[model samples]
Target chain A: MNPIRWLVGRFPTLALARRNLSRATLRSALAVTAVVIGVVAIGAIGMGGEAFKQDQLEAYEGFGGTATVEPASYIEEGNLTNTELSDGDVDRIRQAAGSATVLSVHEPTDALVQTQSGTLLFRAQINGLANPGEFYETRNGTIPDNWRQTVVIGSRIADQNDLEPGDRLRVNVSDEFDRNFEIAAVLRPQGFSAPLGADRTVFVPTSQFESGGYEQVIVRVDTRTGSIDGASQAIEQEFNAREQVVRVEQVQEQREQFTEFFSTVNQFLIGVGAISLLVAAVTIANTMLMSAIERESEIGVLRAYGYPKRAVVSLLVAESTILGVVGAVVGAPIAVGIGMAVNQLLLGDPLAFTAVGIQYVGLGVAFGVVTALVAGLYPAWKAANKRPVEALD
Target chain B: MAPAPGDDGVTADVTGGTVPTDEIIRGTDVVKEYETGGQTVRALKGVDFGIAPADFVAVVGPSGSGKSTLLNLLGLLDVATSGDVRLRGEDVSTFTDREQTRKRKETIGFVFQSFYLIPTLTALENVEMPRMLDRTPTQTRERATQLLERVGLGDRLDHYPDELSGGQKQRVAIARSLINDPDILLADEPTGNLDRDTGDRILELFDELRTDENVAVVTVTHDDYVAEAADRVVTLIDGRVRETEDRRANFEEGPDT
Candidate 1:
């Protein structure tokens, strides 16, 4: 039917629905509140999950899958102890991980260093790197090509010690191997770069720790040419064939695991929310049945006036639908409020309002209205089937 | 005026009495039974009755005389146990529930003792309800307005039923009964709640409807005033027609008419 005709035909039905809802004020309001609670539970939980996923994706945006290869020593979880890597292993990884950049990371945790004049330098922690420029950009002077006795200090460490390039510092590498080194290049500030102290670290050539071996080999895969998975697999197989115990940490795989875990948690929360909506459906059905019973005489009068059974049933359904719609209208905004609260308190940033939330609101409304329609079916049928003569009496 | 031909070879005067050709309703041996508590109770027992267009009939009897049952059967609100009910020569007994509802909408209107006006609706809305159900043409509102005016409720168009007096509420109901221009008007104790003066005024309106609108009005009432004013009175007893008196004969040439 055309729009005008449809409106004309449904006008009376809507008017009657409004009147019926208004006439039984308390019952209708309570029914609306039940629906509101159901929609709120569903919409808020869904939106909260969406917002959290957005936040996590933003935090992990730029860090791509750079594989890290470390020795499989007996180290406990959450413990960052240094393990040995060989120069041979680094050379083999560069050849196996085709077109991938290989850098060796050295770690001698919390070694105290002092000035060349023997004046004590407070809080000077040192680390050694063979090619410090590859790991971090230089803030001032360039790295010396010879660099037989030079060191690079992190930006934070440079700012702390008033140290500059060409300055002399001494590190107690071992009890007898204590040596004085020149600061080669003061590097840029790097926070949590190598999963340990990168900011307060110093860089030295591989010659200084030739007998100590390497701690870990960092493999940078050019994702444009070869996949991270392929590079990681090649490196792992090379070590396995050499019978060298090692563990490869692929960033892409780790990220996927975290995403899967969050999705499962979200699904479980939404399932729990659905239970409240089920209870809401039962409440609407009971309320509609009672309303039908209370209006028997009015229905009889309508029948006697020659209203068809279909019309009677339609009128009752319309009333329940109106209740459902009103409840959804009231619940959606409140759910958004709760979602914002959850984001602020837990995720530390509220989700910026987006069209995505509207889809969730629409889903909530559809759920509420369908519940009401299904629940109201039996009562509407009963009202239609009542005998006019007996109902009038 | 000459007499119109009747099926029994008798004749009916057309000028001031029954018009034989305008037989609007006929019930042939209509029986109504009710099953209450596993026992059958007969409400109507093989009653043969008929009414003509523009006829004023009052069904009168004692408390359990089944007056309401007869009215319900005639209004097409309930089906007879076993018999034929013809409306304008069409057999209504075999009509489906939907067909019955359509037939009632097109031919019958009802007024009850309680007025039965929807409480939420205004006087105008209550009057327009039946026509709206039938999806009558756009002239429905105009006709309902004229009807309310004719029933002396012109100024009370927007008043809800709860705001109206018993007499006014019944007047609104009377206006509602005429909205669809049905041939038959069935009123069951329409003035049962009104005072004597108000009841008389309502009867006067019915009298006017009989002559002005040419409707077949069948009212089930116990009021003697209604019986005295009716063109004919059908007295029922024990679910049967005990007596039928034509009061018109007593005032066949009365000046007040």
Candidate 2:
């Protein structure tokens, strides 16, 4: 109890440490900023990778429908770009199936969009019509009635033009002389549905899209609702006599890729954060070592005055921990906020950062503090061990 | 410069100077050495010494004359390479670091030459440090106040070391050493850095402290005037014991062992 009281009473004495820091405040602040910049850099990398993976996941899950399959042939090629699957293809596959319900779908489009501000003149898959409302259902907005020069524009184009609900945009699909489009309505932002800011999305009605052209057929089979592969195989054998324009999929790999991509990205960023923290640890160690050197005489006096060696060590370690904790308090929140802001700017949408977890922030502080404490240990102990009679000289 | 055999050299040959042989501390065959710049320097070479209860003794020596080394060894701040340093007749050489610290805390008080009060602490806090470390809170406040009052800085308790004069800082140092109430108070060149007037006042405080507390006082000083203030003076030369001057010559040495 008395020792505690004494330490508290002498807390003012320990605060002389601040005067010690003020002599070289700029250098100390620079050291703290080094850790801050590292954290910010880590947050930035985490944000960019989040954007890329989200885009890829949306592209993958676009294959979601009532009964989905990806055949070995269509395993890699999503939404074949240069072929056609007609009602004849559905009829032949149905005739081939006995006692099985079958729907062979192939959505095609040759529509273009022109925007007032800017546009992405890339190809968009005309997703199959078994789930026609999937686009309007998965994403919120009005769907086009048919393929016309008029098109529903993506929000990216709207944002670029500074346009809103009643505004119309013009966009060209491929080259400047290709088909131009006038936007009748703009779509809402749904994750990464439209390729980021700048839109040339033309979602035409299925019939209008089929009237233009398409690449592959999706063969859906309902063998008692659970045996999709049976009808799929019979259709495949029938198509074996023809060119392999159709494919089957397990329907879950699309979602699996999303989980895997995010998990992989999360693991990679955490690894980088850990490595950066390790470097910060070294920085803390160096700082404490230099500070100890500067305060050796002060330490000697404290020891000479009957301060137990244990007390001296604890004082030094506690001082360093306070430094690290103060630095972290200044850094982590700024990083989280900066991450959110940059994501909102570049992705034109809010980006949530799971890069710095609460546990990780705690770990970062521990890393920094432990580093400084360890570095200060030997020096503090040496100070305590100095012979008072010798050191007074 | 070697003293007569069997005579511990710190006692001065003057009126009322010789100390009683049986005392709280005894140093036998004490030797201290240091390696300075790759050369072995012997500081205290087999210096025999003794201090009796309530004796005010001053160890006087020139620079490089081992006075400080002997002080350090006596204060338990450093170890003598080959010596038997006893506390109350028990050899303290083999004690653990904790044991040594406990001994020092309980039995030793130190006043440094430079007035090594903790700079951040006020005069009161500086006096209060050891008592706090030793966990003697109840007596700490009253004793510190009384000692400060004795040193004539009772009103300046809250003033920091830098705010005080050199003598004031030494007085605070003196107050701190007494706060422990040790068997012996050791002052290492306590007045070295003070002006003559401040030095005289500090020595006067030591005298008053001696008269009031009956505590054994050992002061190591380079100044002849400082040594003259003590009842006994011990001289050291080239790491060896020299003359032990009894400042006030005694009729007989007490009960020679």
Candidate 3:
């Protein structure tokens, strides 16, 4: 068949798709716009969930390979054993593991650092002080083991006391003991990394930590598989067999809580996204139905020309699918931008690049297409089945 | 013109002698009934008919005479209760509406008193509709334009149906009917809505279509003058034939028979 002739034979019926939409252009545009809105909502929510998952992974990366070993004391004084892991212990783990970087840590007992501004307590929360080889996370000043009368402050502590390095500090070790001390290393903000070691901490020497001394070691293990786990398990076994008052735990419950909270938020966002899509679908259906009613006679002419009912059905479907695809294509990039903007305002960070994969975008396009078809089906069927005699009369 | 005493003049023994027995349309023992509001009313009673291919005939009757019921049956628009209707030799009683419509498109064309030209279409498009329905676009378009040219609406082809006068609309209608080159033209009072001059022109057009194409033409008219224009006239009253007359029904059988 001469395709143009066949198309012309269809007359206004062929033209009906465009004219049908044009007649109620506002309604049709609104319908497609609804699909766009739905796509944006769904894409943002889906992308946000994936971002949260990444943040959880970043939290794990901050730990590197350190095993925070706990002391063997509890319940009574609400304090675990600070059975200081001496320099020998650090050397032994380094020698035994060979593939690990080990650092021993301790927290001082009673001490108050009084400056020219005011007095702030340098109360160490046990096994948190380092002996000045260089802590991976010092907010300001290094902990000095060479000069025993010096200490380092954490980011939280520095921010809290409005203090900086090169400051003179008065340290009263207890009510009975006092000395003048210098400020050592100040630590940077470690974000969620400090849930393992110390988020709000001050570091001092092993000599300064008199009674309940250091028991833990932060082992930065360069492991591929379960080497951190293996190392921690090995240390626990060694202590258990030797009747030592110490054990190692692979602390991660805090990270798990963070993940669970984010996942719940993600599920809630998805629910809202789905509801928006459903509303968009209804708008599409309504648009098509109105168009069908407008072009009744045009469809009648096609029927009279022996164009067959299915062709009329196909024509309507094709037009709707085009509408859907156009809306989705246009909506996607706009939605991504808006998603980023929303993240910046609500999540308090200019959002990082989150790729809504091509497949996800393709699925969004497919969703738009399917929603349109679903919207167009009944209208197309009614158009196809209309009696030519009735329409002509 | 009076027959000898007791010689009824209608349906004289000429049926076996002069009239050809082979007919293009035959309706036998036909009865059509319609039920309305719990009442069964018979529209036709055991009707019988035969039409020849060359005849230009008009079936004339007053209102409520079952003339329409018989015409509908003959046109294959309605079904008979318990009878056979043959169109061009096949039993049309078994045909579905779609098949009947197809047969009508190929074999029969209709003209209505109301001049039912689709108001939205131009004269050219209206003329083209049936052909578009029946044939390829090239053929249908060529035939439609040719028919319009034939009917003298060649200049006004692009004018909408509403733009045409009654006579011009009828001319376009006539062109449309012949688009598929149908074998029979069924006109129900083709000139009923026109004035004398326009009606005469329409009748003249019908005569041209019939005489030139050799198409069998059946028209239904109430005008005695219109009846006289046909080659033969069949009068109906109370759902029964009252008179069957040729234009020269007064003549006796000559040697030409």
Candidate 4:
């Protein structure tokens, strides 16, 4: 025999419930539709939120091993002094960060750029790294190994000024020194949280800075060979062993903040979804109450024939549960399909569904069943507690 | 211990004789009351009744005579306010709710005037319902089939209640009542909705069940033909047993016997 048939034969209450629900096809269908809507709302929203969060987290993928070490401001002789990191500090950071590349970045300076639009004066962030090729990708031109007397502009600056590689431009640094140099390259636009604020910045050789102290030390660790946490801890210990001298900010911390933010958003969305399920629960309660009222005499007949109160309750609850199961079974796959579409829309990968997303579907289905069961409880109890004599009369 | 007929404190003996030892069910001094609209109304006032095995008893009474109330009490569907209702020599009040349900399922079957067949279930499934409560479907399937065939519903076993006529529905109910092989079948106005021909056929089926299946049949009805067909008729008036007419002696000596 088929498994469902065997199950129905084994549990006659289930069989009766199935038959009873089928008796009012339209009512049962409407009830099931309500549950389906609830399940779809919960599951699809949960899954879509998860996919969005994952996509956001993926944007921070390559920056996980990056950390920025900046000198913390200290009071010196009754005056607040924001000191620059010395060469010794850079050496210590490099030593502490095992198998990591350390680069010193100069403080931003107000500069006048000769663009086709005009001579625009803006605060331009400057990097004084020896090798820019290791940290940045160029969109228009390449950075030479022996890069000297040349400047690399960020994509934002290039786009704003219509500047290109090999273009000759004069930049006045801090209104003190000026030089005309060929633009070596236009760097690609890094995302919002990129170290050194790569966008809206310019790259120059360390020889151009003339200062011995560095404004910021950028450390990039190869996660395969070294741990970012270990590097951050070592850097912090080396600089602030006795007092607060340098502040270490790991990319992981920002990622953690983003994750927390997304988690909160996911919960809120799921809560919104649960409200729909609550409405579905009320619908189920109303449907079950109506069915109990309609079947009062039949229930009395069952009671008179020796069905216990629990049996009557069980029969009614079974009907509701069947509605739940049917709705959830139908809704889960549709929600999954919706999730896939959301993933495709947001993440550009239809198969980017995470295990957590699938778990949300399961959670939605479980909630749907639980909601139906709870909704049916009162009606079942009321029906079961009815006096057979009163019902028959 | 059985209470003496008239000597019992509650009510005089309406059976006009001593309680039989082989009685399947007995009620002594049964009083049932209900609070309706802030006033207490006694549905059955200290009434004594009994049913022996294979007995065909009809309870005939006018409206407000507590015929259905007595049937409800006898079927274990309701409890008496003050009385001793015994089944198979055991006091019914001593049984817990679950035990009462078990006893009712195993020993007594109930039929209703409305037939009360589950509209969703087929004739065979309806017959199998009581046995299904015992959770032995494989064992009772053949019995349900046999009972439906015996009730002349063999061809209509798969037909739902809505598809069956009044007489056919009543026959299905009669078959369902016998599915558990109950010693007593309590029916409240079993033929109240049927025509004269259908009612007569149902009464005949009751007679055949009592004689051939050895099941006692107790029906509460206002139909005189039903009262005439019974081996005994108990008349109730204003919540009290008015008379008990014994026709079993005449029935056994009749031409059919």
CAPRI tier of model 2 = acceptable
As a whole number from 0 to 100, the lDDT of residue A247 in candidate 3 is 62
lDDT of 3 by residue, A101-158 (tens): 6666654455456766666655434334445344455655655547466766566666
- The digit string of per-residue lDDT tens for model 4 on B44-160 reads 887777677677778888989888888888888888898778887798888888888888888888888888899888898899887776767666778988888877789999998
Instruction: Output the lDDT of residue B241, model 1.
Output: 74
Best by lDDT: 4
RMSD of each: 9.7, 7.3, 10.1, 7.3
Worst 10 residues of 1 chain A by lDDT: A189-198
Q: For candidate 1, write residues A1-393 as lDDT tens digits.
A: 566544544476876777888988999999889889889888888887777665655434433657778888765697754467777878888898898878777665545588766766565555555676654568888887666677878777788778899898888766325778888788755433333245677666766774656677777766678777888889889887676578888755656776788778877887777777788788888988999888888788888888889888888898888888888889988998887887786456666544655566677778888877777788889998998898888
Evaluate model 4: give its lDDT: 0.82
* Ranking of candidates on lDDT, top first: 4, 1, 3, 2
Best by TM-score: 4
Please write out the lDDT profile of model 1 over residues B1-257, one tens digit for every residue: 11212223213422334434567766666788999999999888777667776677788989787888988888889988877677877888788889888888878888977877887788988898776644543567789889889888899999999999988998999889888788889998877878999888887787677667777778998888887777778888878777668443211111211
Where in model 4 is the C-alpha error above 4 Å? A1-7, A71-217, A222-243, A256-275, A345-348, B1-17, B244-257
lDDT of 4 at A138: 91
Taking the tens digit of each residue's C-alpha lDDT, what string does model 3 give over B1-257? 11111122223222244333445576665667877689987766555666655456778878776777766666665678766677866889888656765676677676756666766567987877665434367777778889898878889989988899888988888888787676677777877777888777767766676566756677888877678777667776666556668443311222221
Q: For residue B49, give model 1's deviation from the true position in Å.
A: 1.3
Among all windows of 10 consecutive residues in model 4 chain B, the one with the lowest summed lDDT is B248-257
Give the DockQ-based CAPRI class for model 1.
acceptable
